[model samples]
Target chain A: MKTEKTLVTITEEMVLNYEVIFGKQNKLPPTFPMIFYRYINVPWDYKTAPIHRKQTCVCHSELSIGESYHCVVTLDQVKQKGKYMFYTQSLVGYNLEGSECFRCVSELVVH
Target chain B: MCVRISRTLTITEEKIKQYAFLSGDFNQIHLDQKEAERYKFKEPIAHGMLTMGLTLEIASSFTEKGMRISTYEMQFIKPIFQNDLIYIVAKKKKQDYGSIYLEITGRKQNELVVRGELALERLSSIHFNNATKESGM
Candidate 1:
């Protein structure tokens, strides 16, 4: 396989694709009647070990029912892509309510 | 306070399939038991992300009125096999009107197989008002 990089946007189709993967869309209480967004970039045909590097930024539209929140997550490989494959995911807590967004970011390398 | 709950779940092949569909993670280890056994795990295991997603479901059940998860972190500990009766648990260890800390765990036959913690900010109604005032949401 050749090395490839794909940037996938969170759209209705992508959400449907994820729903297909999980089987039951209702099992997860998605903030429906609203839109959920994410950006996924994957590097294929990795030269080193088959390690996947991902970054997820999640945001939801305002809903009439409950409170709305925005959160961001950044995950990086801890190891130098050799010996061991280590990955660490950092979460940023943001309420996105009242212009107040909680934010935090962490990095990890797997060997 | 920690938001927590527990339930015994039948990890059926169909359930796994659904999870695979939702995550876009159709790895063979989760779909093929025979191929899974060939690997070091010796049995088909669920996707780590899927397991985490399930754990999130369990935690969401305990959310108090008007509260939503703002952030969380999970680490994959062990593989959950198909048809295994696994116990899933989540607890709220700390909380406030603004933020909450949650601890979640998963077990098979009473043995610890997975564990993680989450930090969720309480989604307040005040923000939606501002979003509406600013963006007409």
Candidate 2:
């Protein structure tokens, strides 16, 4: 199991940029977790790279701008199905109080 | 108990590129035509989250009064090729206490591409507005 962590902050500019393209909303978009992907830092083969197949996000608290989050991504499990490797990873965010603000579990299929 | 809204969206390469840079996925399957052709897809695919983000925007519109998302789950049933138009729909499931449930669906060319469920927590209008106003939203 590989675990990686990074501090993520949602700046006003990011929200503005997203809103410009996706439209403005009262709350940060659920896709806000995407900011954590750069920290994935994992290497893979493009010819047989993992493709996103499923996602689940549970929000425990509302995300406010300027909130610093400790984001963590971990490889939870892997299964080989014929010619594909189904990998499941858990992504979570914690607020200053160390309380879970959100969790997103992503399943990727690699050929 | 039942409500529905639908819209047609055309996702462009420029849109996918923006998401790629923001998310930092850079899987090549989502960018780089030559690299993407190396795979079985033979064409670039949009990020799954990009679609999810759009879905959320739709839900947010429905809850502008005071509701906020609580839980969202999505299944990528099929690959959505870039520059293709996708039809999205959101239907109200039910409401319990201070929460409203919704079922979301996305399709490309009449083929189901993604399906998901969304739950929104009902908050006081003033409360929700106050939270967002802090950011000058």
Candidate 3:
């Protein structure tokens, strides 16, 4: 079977669901969703927000917050099989006050 | 393909929950040990991003000061269970025009868990300049 990729945006409702799942310990950090377009030609549809200075966290430094601006990107991934499959192809955060380049982190999960 | 550094870490259920708290990824396969077993995993596995973050941390340590990662790509080969002692190894693969390329691998004992690449560039040359220019610095 051919794999399919789709971009998903975490809406407010999804965040609320996460809160429901996490219950009392529901301190979910905001993250910008992005895709590594390897061999696809798809137009960027997600609206880009105005860059504003704010404190943000990235990857392993999740506890030590730093200054940054939010950038949202749409992600496309191969359709996963089974109930427990999730692939976080990349995780990135850009420094608002320091640099235009963003820090990228990547990983995958299959069940 | 030289210059390699490795760091060891133990993945715990609490740490996995912490990652889920940060990333908003509360997948039961990663949070519930019983559910994970039903799904065929021995136990709740750690979030892939958590492992990726550690890999990036190791990669960042080898680069020059002021260098920032621009691109990171990885592939997950196996599930990482709780308390698994993971060894993250990063090797400098190539460099050109201030861009350093690195190969990263995560292994549990002799078993490969994840593999990927990273691209690093000087912060001052790339986004830093633009940020400064925008700030009229």
Ranking of all candidate structures by their lDDT, best first: 2, 3, 1
Lowest summed lDDT across 10 adjacent residues in model 3 chain B is found at: B55-64
Query: How accurately is candidate 3 docked according to DockQ?
Result: 0.07
Candidate 1 to truth, TM: 0.61
TM-score for each candidate, following the candidate numbering: 0.61, 0.88, 0.59
Q: Candidate 1, residues B1-137: lDDT per residue as tens digits?
A: 23346776666787677765555556676787676765555677765555555555565443544455544455445567777787887777876556566777778877887776665544564365446778866
Task: Write down the worst ten-residue block by lDDT for model 3 chain A.
Answer: A46-55
lDDT of 2 by residue, B1-137 (tens): 46787887877898888888777777788988887788767689888888888767677565687678878899999888888899999898888767778899998888999999998886564356447765789
Tens digit of per-residue lDDT, candidate 1, span A1-111: 111222222355545655554333432232221122122323322233221222222223222223444434444334455555555543333343434333322232222
Off by over 4 Å in 1: A1-41, A44-75, A78-83, A88-111, B1-4, B62-64, B125-137
TM (B chain), model 1: 0.76
Docking class of 1: incorrect
lDDT string, candidate 3, A2-81, tens digits: 12333233356444543343332112222223222222233432121111111122332221123333333334343455
Better model by lDDT, 1 or 2? 2
